[model samples]
Target: MEHKPLDQLRSVADVQPRPLSREERLQRWIDLLETDPKRRLSSLGEIEYKPPAERALLREDDSPLTVAYEDPVLRADGLSSDRLGDAMRYFALSDGQAHYALCSCLSGRTMEAGTCAQRLRNATGNVAWESAVGAWLLAALAVSLPGLVYLLS
Candidate 1:
């Protein structure tokens, strides 16, 4: 007689192992999320997360928290230190276009600030009334500027 492997000796499916129930499957998924440090929710409590390398790495000196604390650039847009982390996390989960917009905004490109912020807002679905109002105001000014100058001159 020759000794054979267990798999060859018997079909394990014949033993009828228990299939996972719906609740068990759900629990297992929850457990996996809870136990996985990388998958686990951060203080922001968002399910989607990015690894540190993927997130914007602002140095202490360049951090908006420190250098921009008093600057109104980010603050004026309601992105203070308190909400900055959440925005960065959002950017991490968003597309490259949003990330580029955020980078432009954070890197002090004032000319593109409003557009960049709008892009970020669009990505996060948190467009503010003030931003809309400002856009209208700017548009009105732009449309009226040439006529106003012509009238005055």
Candidate 2:
């Protein structure tokens, strides 16, 4: 094998694309999901106009389930793609909850109690009922905590 010239050498950083900012990653997910091409390109431009901090926070959510359900197509594409790992990390669900939610989302976008119970069993093996219930309860609490705190205070 011929050795590459110094001019032909490339750093690892150069070879590997820089990781996308949170805003761009979210926009990529939108690009994957949006059926309308114009709206997709338009969204890219819109995100650029946002302040960096606001754009960074566009995808942040206290509730994983809320993020998972925000857009059916985005969720479906994410669940099906390499972005599953990113989605899982961002959601911060426990392994059992992540698997169960992923399975349910893969099957359909809904995670209704009945379906969650059934999917949890199939996805999580033993003691799935409690895991599923706990996941639901935690997700509910995450969504409602601010309101509950305000109401109680």
Top TM-score model = 1
As a TM-score, model 1 comes out at 0.24
Model 1: per-residue Cα lDDT over 1-153, one tens digit each = 986766865664453335544334323322333333232111211112445444443323322223224344333433345333543442233445334433433344322223433443454443556688999999999999999999999
> Where does the lowest 10-residue lDDT sum fall in candidate 1?
39-48
Q: Each candidate's TM vs. the true structure? A: 0.24, 0.24
- Candidate 2 structure quality by residue, lDDT tens digits, 1-153: 777755556642244335455444444433333323222110111333456455333332212333334555544444332233445454333554545433423444333333433443344344666778999999999999999999999
**Clashing residue pairs in candidate 1 (N, C-alpha, C atoms within 3 angstroms):** none
lDDT of 1: 0.40
